[model samples]
Target chain A: MSTSADTVSMGGGNNSPSIRAKVQAFGGFLTNMVLPNIGAFIAWGLLTALFIPSGWMPNEEFAKIVGPAINFLLPLLLAITGGRMVGGQRGAVMGAIGAIGLIVGADIPMFLGAMVIGPLGGLIIKKFDGLLENRIPAGFEMIVNNFSLGILGFLLMLVSFEFIGPVIEAANNGITVAIEALVATGLLPLLSLINEPAKVLFLNNVIDQGIYYPLGMQAAAEQGKSIYFTVASNPGPGLGLLLAFTFFGGKTSKRTAPGAMIIHFLGGIHELYFPYVLMKPLTIVGMIGGGMTGIAVFELFDAGLVAGPSPGSIFAYLGLTPKGSFIGIIAGVLAAAGVTFLITSLILKMDKNTEETEEENLNESIEKSKAMKQEGKEVSAASEQHTTQIEKISFACDAGAGSSAMGATAFRKKLHKKGIEGIEVKHYRIEDVPEDANIVVVHKDLLDRAKIAHSDKEIITIENFLDDPNLHGLLERLENVSK
Target chain B: MLGEHLKGNVRFLESVNSWEEAIRESAAPLLENGSITSKYVDDMIQNVNTNGPYIVVVPEFAMPHAKNENSVEKTGISFLQLQEPVMFPDDKEVKVLFALAAEDSTGHLDLISDLSGVLMEDEARDELKQAKSEKEIIDLINSVE
Candidate 1:
């Protein structure tokens, strides 16, 4: 049931196939370039996790490992990789040179900034290479190439320092101001409200890579660890929800929740549990409660991480924890789990009838969808003002497969039973909704997210894919337009 | 558990022209057994065509099925193995097809879960792929229990 929703960001255009292709190409580049280096990132995570001052190796010699790795080597390695992706060996060197400029000139990790500058440096070098392709004399090629590269490296370093460096610093400062205000107002835990929902919406990258990474790098550079790194990356809330579902859920939950828990908690793909929460929007309170609990304990114990854990794995969590603060982190996670379990159990119990209604709605929608084929004549009469017809209907979920795929199957059968032909129906991950999709169907909980991602597209929200009356209404609308 | 229904329902075909042909050939046994109507087979094929290949659960496996809409007379599963795999447009190739017809969405989940459990075991899957007779496939399903 694995769906391709987590990574694909669709263009919000019915006519813009070019825009869709560009978005897909960029998404592919980002995923291919960055995903392979996760091992390196995890290794860096391990180093900072275990060798920091409060870690297993508290010796001064081991503590020395944290500085150069986080501040220089890791970011430099990432830049080299990104540059190699965009250009070749020469671009890799310029990318590293550009990153080094940022590393030396700034107080933060500079890794996030490197991702952008590295590609830019690589592109510049590639352009230079292209310009000089046949212009250099054969005899003086080596000399010319070496001297020009040195000059280019120096120029890129200047560009990183004099230009991009200040912009990054300013962005970091602005985020810091917002965070400091929250902390100053004694509302740090309130971040959980925003963070948990955003994470479920698959906006973890925006919050982590876009905002927290720079701040965390700066914080880690100053201190041994940064709490900024741990704020949203913690898996405790997700773990709590999954645990609750496994123990106290319905039949489907009991069957699937355990597998999801292992993948989510240990494997560190928190997106696995998002559908469980989406199935019941009321359970978001559990997530909020768990998040608040974890953050509260982190603050109370002053527990922090040497670097941001990408997957938020427990091993990564412990690896980054300061010496005595390990217990605090554990306590925070357990407390979050306990609170979430209690809230989720209650919500699940209360929503039993609502869940039943959802199932009924699904069956009803199927019946109505089938009825549309027989009632095609009635639809054509209503077509006078309806010109915007939906050519394609796509069902989208967290990963795009489990619920949405099944829903699409049921819907398709309904259409076929009614003798409705040629209308395309497909399923995708919410992020990967195809540009041509006229109506994007998503679980009700993801309505806000679908809107944010594709504001111009017509979206249909259902409590669950099985029982949505909206699908029938949408088909009626489509029929009117089709006529 | 699935072995009881697999008696006289399992077949290993030499080849097929397309995935739709493979699906129809797989479901033929169930249709003969009165487990499903011909409409059910058409609906299942239509599902695969419209929704891409979500049915191809594993590298070389697919379970082609559709939701019940008076097309299913009973819950049944027919197993077929092709000598050469049929390729779907999505790059998923299916050497084995499990044509499932359920009375309702939740009706045959337990059987599906049990079947998935067996399919996931490499040893069981390898045995099923190579088995020439129905008894061997039944024995493998029994061993899973």
Candidate 2:
């Protein structure tokens, strides 16, 4: 069982992440993309609140900023951030390039689409760059890197623009049909299933204003009250969601929820709460639950706004409330809020419980890494030497400056002299050695730092940057393995 | 570029009291020509203070450098050779110091490439300790570079 990673590839024994861990990692990536751009969304919501025709201080000209902002700016930012997360700066460029195609090609704002495309673009370029990595001649790296991205991005833009329309059209059609089928079931509360999800996707207007408001208006003409108006436009569910976040959300979400609440509940900007749902995704259950409760409450008391509440704010809700229907309307909103708050708090609490333990394990792992390092080193060193499949070797120094760079440069020269290929040798600060590096070469002097920072990897300690005996041993092992 | 940057920045010292004094004395040329500020000298010393003597790239050859952090006005390299070796931490003796003042990370890699080229071979590294003049040291670097 004790095998020295003498062949240079250190991670042959590492286990892959479990399903839950993989899902959480993906979820964390989603949260990272949405978290930074929430401020931009808030700004757009504030502008929509103040300037839209249904808004408090409606201004025709200033309101024009809303459409372009939502359609172009917010989506682009999300794509750029997502792309950068996967691909680095070039990925960001690729993300933006790919996103513009989606924006121009599709009729919708492309929020979710951009999220997908950005990372896809980043991944594309990252792979392309990886393929081109040492193959580019020394003097031509900059030109090759830029042109590869430029050409790939151009083709990606064409591909996205050419093919995205049918996909978006298909999704929009699917949502509309799902809404129609839910309405046909006559189980009014069931509408929340479609409504809540649609609302988060910026499809609020398509369902509420397009479908429900018309149906409610027709029903109102006959009976002076209908539950359709309250079905999707109830600000209760959004308010409850935000309130739950204020009390129970992650740190940044908690700090920002109060402002979002003000915009969602009072200002009637339902879009304000969309990012919160997008972040947790599971919180959509809370939204649907609150929504169904609100609709059931309205139908119980035969409550309806005589007209549609344009902005769907609490004020708008009351202003449109038929006089005798006040109690019913108020009760519906309150009930929805209470139900959503309870459900969302439970979800957030459950998330936090898992998160806290993950954090504890993370802290424990730091301490545990020392023991693991010793065990790993002994096993690797004592066992038969492994064969070479070394993909990445990181050289680390204190400031990422002197010794590490020298070591890395010299090691690269040795690798080239030995005609080794596909093994990435690079230097970093002691703490910045990437997770994917199979082996970290640190000077014997900084062994403690290397062990603490990168305990998961095989560590090779050398006394000299140029010609240490360990270096010679490693080189000979590589030569034998390569042969 | 590597030889040109070190043209007038080479000096000879008989000995230094400690590795700290060796680094300070080694980096003095960069300070005089305004290639780097005094803070960079302090950072390089602090790097050793916290990180041990990893900057001593070879057995008796030390390379002192730090994150520029706006402390370097331009990229330059300097050299110092001592007749009597100085005792670094852990009893490692260093006779030659290469003070590297890079304004940014990638700018002065050629200097490192040449330095590594010089030290990679045993005979050149041994001759480096014996090189008597600045021109001789520069030519030795050029010979391998």
Candidate 3:
């Protein structure tokens, strides 16, 4: 069951995660919630691709799956899952209830609204649950919880119908008008500036599911195909970046980008490229350049697709293309890749760290470690000397995934090698950390947050989580307490 | 692994007033074994106080752990089956508590992986819930893989 996310306050301190982090987290959360049901989306895409009269093997009877899949099941599932992530079973119920408003209020499929409304409803129910926690008397808990959700859900449903329903309809209309105007004026390529960045930030599903899918469905129902489906869902820009990174980027990118390229361009999981781009902010300009070129090429060729490719797979894009439009689609993809590669190669030249040979790099790290250990012994012997046992050591980060989790694992391995016993080392999201944590290890970027969260506790900042030299100091302090 | 703790540390508690009490009861065996320090126990209970009960990880089950690296004297896992379920603030009720203490993050991973395997199988979890003695619980764990 999903609970409300601990609200992270922004604009508080320089060390707190940026506004970009919050948006990225929200996008990450949405991506995670929707990812499990990718198969269902594929099923709908397949059905639409095969049976839509102009399809490969048109079958009207089998095509019946399209309506239910698009109109009800997809959005219904998204709401339940998104809401469940926010609240729990109660939240899921209310989120599903609230989502029905967007579904019935408009002629278009309301998957985007479901993504928002369900989570919002669940969050509201969770807030109510929090306020009433411990206040509900024993034996009367079940009834009160049930009645509260029922009343609150009903009120939310009304609010959704009366207020939210119309608002979404109007917003959808506004966007549609805007897109039509852009397309008419040959200014549609400008959308790549917004869509490409959002896509790399992992808002691909929201753009595809919320905006592209519904609009494409409407257009495809009237015409044979919709260019709107191909606009944001193109795999070209990401492929371009990966190709450039594979051949021209630093050693790390050169090694990893090929595998990522395979997963992204071929497998159609656009998310594989996000981390790569995130690691190098300057690389986004390459993606933006590629995205604009892709759109421009599509416009040049007048290319469109029968359906939105679920994973934005290159193969699926080709399959969905009209008989005569195959060259146009291929041209757009190649042009996007060529443009991205040219820009990326230039940007990567400024990346100086990856130039060192593996042996030299290893030697440098070893020398650095020796210097750090020498420094660590003195630091441990000084004012931070342990007088009492530390029961808890928490490795905290923004999302608590990459750095903190790996740091804890590496630190654990170090402790095991040292024969250290009975120390609980774990990774946690900064906000979810328990107050009982004796020592909090956080990234230097998150030091301010750690200080604010645990003012009384020891806050250790690690500049590089992967090879944190301060871990030795922490271990030395732990050993001193044990002695 | 969990086998050592399961053989001697597993217990069936008759009753508990609150979730905190249940956690304390669950960790008592670990504390007795010197697997965890007394301060670790307090910290574990305090984790719930601060973080709410995200510990009820699976249905009818709770895995209460603390970030108390210093409180850990050994790596161990203890089981406590409550006769009556204790409800957390989130309205989720839990009957089984797996209190884990690890001196380091990498230690006791095999035990956790095995326990998760047992928990995933409905029949195994049911067998665990019904087993009255530690030997039976040990047998159930052995039988899973």
DockQ of 1: 0.02
lDDT (tens digit, per residue) of candidate 2 on A1-483: 012111111221223432322333344455556657756754665565456665568899987887788778877898898888777789899999998998899866676667778889988987787677768888998889889999999998988888864585467556646654755564778878777876664446556644565355434434444567789999999999999989987666677789989988999988677766655567788888999999888877878775557678999788667646789999999999999999999988988955544434333433333333334333333221221236688888877766788888998899889886556888888898998888899988889988999878889999999989998888886666555
Which residue segments of model 3 deviate by more than 4 Å? A1-16, A135-142, A195-229, A242-260, A269-285, A305-312, A315-326, A342-483, B1-145
Model 2 RMSD, rounded to 1 decimal:
15.3
| lDDT (0 to 1) per candidate | 0.70, 0.76, 0.71
Backbone N/Cα/C clashes per model = 7, 2, 15
Model 3, position A292, has a per-residue lDDT of 84
| TM-score of chain A, model number 1 | 0.64
Supply the DockQ value of model 2: 0.51
Distance from true location, Cα of A455 in model 1, Å: 44
RMSD of each: 24.6, 15.3, 20.8
Residue-wise C-alpha lDDT for candidate 1, range A1-483, written one tens digit per residue: 012122221111122324333333443344444556667665665666566665566567766866787778777877887787666688788889998888888877786777777777777886777567546776998998888889999988988888798887677677788997987776888888777766655456556755665577667667656777777887888888888877777666767788888888788888677767655656778888888888888888877776667677787787666666778888887787788888888877776666545544434433432332223323332331232245468887554534555556656655655655445677776788888788888766567768988898988876424435787776565554544
Query: B47-123 in candidate 3: lDDT tens per residue?
Result: 66665554554567777777754888887889999878888656768789888776765556566656665675678
TM-score, ranked from best to worst:
1, 3, 2
TM-score of chain B of each: 0.96, 0.97, 0.94
